[model samples]
Target chain A: MNEKLHPFHIMILIYMNQTGVVIMSLPHLLAENFGYNGWLGVILISLVVNLNIFIISIVYRLGKGKSIFQIMESSLPRVITFPIYMILIGVWSMTGCMVIKNYVYIYQIMSYNTTHAMLLKLLIDIIAYLLIIKGIYTISKAATSFFWITSWMLLLQLFFIKDFEWARLTPFLFKGDTHFLTGGFIVFTAFLGYELCFMLFPYADNPKKFIKSVYKGNLITTLTYLIFCLICFGFYSFEQIRNMMYPLLDLLSYIRLPFIERIENLLFGFFLFTTIVSVVLYSWSAQETFARIVPKANKKVLAFIILTFGYIVAWFPDTLSEVGQWLQYLGYAELGVAFGLPLLLILILVIHKGAKPS
Target chain B: MRTMPKAAALLLVIVIIAGCGDQRILEKQGFIQSTGYDLNGTKNDEKDNRLMITVDIPKSDPEQRMQRETLTAIAHSSKEAKILFAGQTELSLVSGQLRSTLFGVSLAKTGIWKHIDTLVRDPSISQRVKIVVVNGRAHDLLVRDYPQHPRAGQYIDRMLEKESALMSFPLVTIYDFSRDYFDDGIEPIAPIIRENKKNISFDGIALFKKDRYITKIESKQSLIFSMMKQNFKKGEISMKLGDGSKKQEYLLFSSVISNRNVKVKRSTKGNFNIQINIVVKGSVLEYSGSHELSKDYDRKKIEKRMAEYIENEAAALMATMQKHNVDSLGIGRNVRNSLSYEEWNKLDWNKEYPDADIRISARIVIKDFGKFK
Candidate 1:
């Protein structure tokens, strides 16, 4: 619990959390919203996320590197802060459970149709639980390893360059349907996991250096998203991408080597590492929020409670669409907390400073 | 703590064992390599089946690895046929290894979208599986055994792969088919194969308007269409050029590299004029023309003649496509790019494709002659 994460670990942790299971369907979402050359919208979305990151950095500076709970509780009334903590706990744990649930749903659909989905999700949950019990420092260390394991997947994009066509990208800019609102929202949600960084203030030795690592982590994630979206746009036509359920998976399936075929199955299995990291991180955040509320609770017991709560909740959505619906709602709520929490903290800090001179 | 470790180990053991329940035994699973769909032409009032589906499942036994078990079922849907197929085989039929899907000419003429939609929907099926059109009954093609090709399914798969690489015909997978089918600017196409004597042969390029097979490009003219359709580094094209007074002149170019450029301009009317320019460079492997290859000027004359021959052939090819109202060359894509978004949306490309004036020109450069020259 006393260990602090290195700047490199922080960077890779943020990158891993941002990438989760959404990457497989991201190309289809972009094509649906922005049409041809919709990949250009990722840069715009990334800038908005960077602005959010900037806001969080401001909170870190104004609060003098104190924990977010410390800053909020000291200024706000217990009545106001208590419900905010409850909402954060609900939103974060639900997001955590939904991420794994969505992954397991897709896994069952792609590989194990006969296997029980909850059984599969339970297996994933157990793996995530083993990691979450170790705390954030260990999770960050494990995340650095997961980052190395999954980042090499971007190199597979090279295989598509032979068939990639500029004409398929088209000459139009943002020529898709009127669904840009939902598209922007979905793309915005892909960047949602970074907002959990505010919970990491106490774990940072230097707040200024930690914020820099967050930006670096976000840069890596944005580039990864940009590369994937561009390859999918150029490899598949606008209409084909729109019709595909998971264009990235299909692209991976098309890769055939002399020794191996259907590498998508293996690569998708490797994605388990990143998914586990994301699940553990989100659950850890929820557990930390729980600890703030109940100061005397055991950390391990709190983690168990959160995981059990998540496991029970995962049973309701037996199908992929249902899981996806819940995830979309949770994503929207997290996005609200991501922006709202920081602005609220800044409001408290400014009022406190104005009310009493230093 | 010791009991906890033991409990964890027991849990791991149970999970490891329970996870094996979903394991698929290789010998027990019958992998369908080739599937053929044909319209039932027989008049059987009792069994009103629209589709005659045939599958080639290779035997798992090493001694009979070369042999395949062919199963045929008549059902309205592919899944229905799949259930019927499962009843005949002890081995569980799976489509994870499906390599090629063949549609009979009769069935293809009607439209293949519904069957293709099912294949696309199945998560187990690969997107790279070759989509082929059969000139004869697809049932006949799959049912017969070729003497020379011990494993006909594997032979067809390898042949399509090699031919597609040689640019004899474009390789149209399910991914390509659906991509072009969905794109408003271009239509889809597939290669046609037929049973010829003891083996299967590449017939030609099958053209489609939407999902129905409209026409075909003859094998001889397939090279011309391939050149205009895409840019490739290697292919072969043979052309015949001469006057009535001279001996019949024929030139065959090997390792032909071709690059195509399409320019679209709005004509005086509300229609469009499309200009296609193809630059080809090749080494002469066989020349029976009057021009002497040893001389630069004579070689230039042969090049000019070959260029002229290609231009005329492409013009004829474009005319045939326009006559049938099939924009197989993706000329509509270029025209769409030339217009604004609203104009492209309002215009019916299929209607404007035939009325638009199209021209083709070829520039051929002989990079190398043979050692004989």
Candidate 2:
């Protein structure tokens, strides 16, 4: 309990979570939703996400450095807080499980087609469980190393510069679009992981430093999304990007080094580290929520039980589309939590302040 | 002691399930190095089946007399053909290492998106695989044995790679093919290869409208096409100058570097007036002209003449493209940039392309006339 997270660790944790399996399909989604020069819309989406981050910061300032559980339990009775905690555990664990399940399903399509997806999911679950049992401080520490392992893939975008064409991006802005509302929601989900920082209010060495790091984390995620979407738009035609299921994977497949070709297979595996950080971070959050209900239980045992539940739930979605449909619902629910939690906490803080004057 | 027995059983189960996944062993799997697609037969053939898929798999054993094995099968679709191909060999045919996919002129002229879609859809195939348009039947090019070359597949792959560097043809891959095909402003193009007397040769560049081949730019004009297509650091261009009455002179430019710009302006006539300017810099390796290199006056004279020659040739090439109603140079892309999105969408580019006023101008800079002054 004495070990607190550094601001840098918090920044990386937010980044790794925001940049999971979604990156591979993000360009295609943008192309489908916003049409020509859809990448320009990422800046707008990032700005909006910053506003959401502002709300989370307000909760931090209002709650006065208290842990989320302390602030919530003090305001609401056990009857109200307990059901909220259960809902949080359900949504958080399923979101973590589906993120990995979607990744393994795509991995199956890429290389291990005949392998049982459940087996691969179990393998990833075991890695997540090991990391989750270590607790938040270790997970954040491991995330910094995981960030290094995957961030170099960004440099690969430079190879595409020779073929990237400004003309291919087209002059039209937001033309040929079909679904702006849904597209905005999907893109907003790309910045979903930063909200987990709320749980870290108590763990942060200083609330002021934590809030600043949250903005920096969101900024980094925005830059990563912009770089990827812009390169995809320039490297491919508008129609080509829309048609592709995973433009990032296809882009990686195009890269040819003297020693190797089809580097995507290996590079995509490196993403497992980053995704493991994300899944573990989410599982840790769920386990923290679970501990509130069973206060006397050991933390590691609760984490194991939560992960076992995740493993069982992950088995339900057998195909990629089915998993995607499940992720759509979870992503929206998580986004709701991301915005809803901070707003509710702020409302509670305001009401408490008003009643204290009486 | 009790836990030891349980752990042993769990590990054994894990090991057994691990082996159950699809394992593509190198020796057991036939790594398809190159593939060819041709029309099954003449159009009049009674059977409705239309695809003839040929694949070249390099033989692994050095002791074998043949360098590669070529297999051909006729079926309704490529996947069906793949199954037939697999039945003929002990190794399961796979496309992970597929280096190239060749389409016969016959098939390319009709349309090629169906086969290309299959290539793009398969997760195993690399997008960098060279896409080619064979001048004759793709089957003949795949099956032919050249006396001094490696296997036909490897030879063509190497040829395409080398020729691409020479700027003799555009190095279109599966990615580029589909990318351009999907772009509304421009069409896709691929290098054409033909089975020659002793070996294969770079035939030309096949221009495509959508996914169907429209016309071709010959090998000689391919350099001109390259100059207009994109900027290059190394290439060679040889031109014969002078009218028939005067003695003709030859000028060979090597180590060529060039940059091109397309400018589109809306004229008073309510149409796009496009100007294509190309700036070329290279050393003249050979000049049979009477102009003396040491003299500034003669150098200017030759430069002007060379520039004029390039301009004329480029204008002629543009005419060929316009006549064929193909915008392979991506003039539509330039025009699109100059207009609003709604205007571009409303305009029929193909209908407008042939009537557009396009002009070509060149500027030539000779760095060195050779090792001599």
Candidate 3:
């Protein structure tokens, strides 16, 4: 079943998950830290992130057909694998919830002024459940289709080129090196979902092609993110972009289409599509992690259980601002799971001289 | 077979939901085409900072004319003033189609930045809306109707676009005003509108020293001021030139394209000197005499003559602006952006701006003319 997904499909899935919420919020976050040169910080972060992908690909290749979870399970004790998997599942589910909540909040802000919040939550929950039921291959196909949709939507951003002011990107390197370094770290956290590929290594039809997929995915995601950052920088001044909460949405709101009075609504739907794909991919990873931990557990049942739990977790945050605060904390925690866990797992695999190639 | 029914139901439901979102809310919501704010002074034995707000909404007519209505609300805050207008007008003031926000001279003098902030922060209000200051009362600009246009909002909007396009005034949007208001080095300039004989036109540009309207630059000077700051698609300059025999010739040259480059350098006297280089690509439309030599005239001679004329005009304009303490040319911004903080503080930009040696140079390359040379 996993063999059906082409390397391109996997690349689209990974790119969508990494680029969605991160691109929408990173400009505002980096601007708050670095002020005028926040965009420069984003460029530096993209470079570092691409380098990090190279390192991760090296680590994944060193594992030799063993997925990160499998390597962790074999290299470490059963006691450690179960607990670590549980923690990983919890973090993934929380990340999924945050993405859904953020996307829903944006939808509500742009579209339904009078619609009940519960109805929107219910709609998102039902959609997530249906996608989860359809399984990983179907989700990958959906993500592949969405890749084109996102590209076309991105092309519409050219209308705002007339308003682009190069002066807004000026006072280059103004906030100094320390601010840039710190902002880069914050931006690095935004690209956290790249490690999802490490978990899906065993499922890949041609595991040899995993490195190529990861590099292509990272390149596409980085380029897309840079385009968004450039648009935000172009549409608004440095101070205005810095002050904005969701610079992407704010930038979209400024775009006026002839037939579509509010382009933000259409943009909101496109972003929501990406967000849903991201959540589904992460949730599937979490569910599979749980299934691997419990040998007797049914994978389908576990998927359903995890999807329901994710819905409950998403409901915990009553308001958008609270969800944002939770996501910030979750982002910090993801640093450990996304970066530290892989490094540790890779280190242990090397120490034990884990499984050679078939 | 059972799943077939379920899938069909789902598809039907999706189609129905998609069809339900077809309401033209903006049209029904009575779009506030333009808004005006005025200081109504204290009223009724209360120290109420009264505000008069005018909302222009599309009139319910076959002709699609706009109905202009004014609501007087006594409130200490602009937000309250807006809410009061909502109560009086009985229509939710939708700002999505808002063309411009006019501020009366009195209100502008009292510092209307806080009021403007309320409009800027509202997500519903558009940032592209033009912001202007009225020379007389804001109500006059909003209330007066043109026989041709009918709607005051549409009239003011077209007038602003025409004047800005003609290179007579700077196009100042709400976003531009807000950005300049926040930025320290740059000052905001908005078109000032006035009503005379039931017709409206751009009176001048109200120059703001931060939030306060400090001075006004009337028509032709506004053009010269904008020329220094912005690139124009088309501009015309009529110059009076003398022949070798002292016979004067009037040359009408229309610029097809123009670019201005401003550079600020710290002088040895611890002050700043600005150098302006203007490159123009234009065609000679008309000349006083039959001095047609050829299509390819002396490019160097034309450049020199045009350069001298532009330099004198630019220097005079800069001197006049310096006298009025208007830094609309963004000299301070250039200094702050290009220099370090310590170096910027050492030079008093406001004091040195007027007396600073403004050297101007123009390079006019004639592109083409009509049928005549």
Model with the higher lDDT, candidate 1 or 3: 1
Please give, for residues B1-373, the per-residue lDDT of candidate 3 as tens digits.
Answer: 5865796687568646744644444434667788788887633534546677776766554564435554555676767766777777656666667778889997898788887777676666666778889998887667766786757878788878876776776778877887777555667888887888858777888888777888887765565566677677876767776546867767777865888887878767766777888888888777664455253455456556666766677778777667878787776677777776556556577777677777777777767656764
Interface RMSD of the candidates, in order: 1.7, 1.8, 3.6
Docking class of 1: medium
Report the C-alpha lDDT of model 1 over A1-358, residue by residue, as the tens digit: 5888788889889988888888878888888887778888889889989999999999888888788888887878989988999999998898899998888877776787777777777777877877888789889988998888777888888998998887777777887574788889987877778888898998996666899999998999899999989998888878878888888778878888888787778888888887787788899999999998999989989998999998898888867889888988899999999999999999988888622222
Reference-based TM-score, model 3:
0.89
Candidate 1, B70: how far from true, in Å? 0.2
Query: Among these predicted structures, which one has the highest lDDT?
Result: 2
Q: After superposition, how far is residue A152 of candidate 3 from its true place, in Å?
A: 2.4
lDDT of 1 at B97: 94
Query: lDDT scores for all predictions?
Result: 0.86, 0.88, 0.72
TM-score of each: 0.97, 0.97, 0.89
Candidate order, DockQ descending? 2, 1, 3
lDDT of 2: 0.88
**Model 3 over residues A139-242: C-alpha lDDT tens digits?**
88888888888778778778778867565555555453235555656677777677787767776767777678877887787777777777676566656666
Candidate 2 chain B, which ten residues in sequence have the lowest lDDT sum?
A: B3-12
Two-way DockQ contest, 1 vs 3, winner:
1
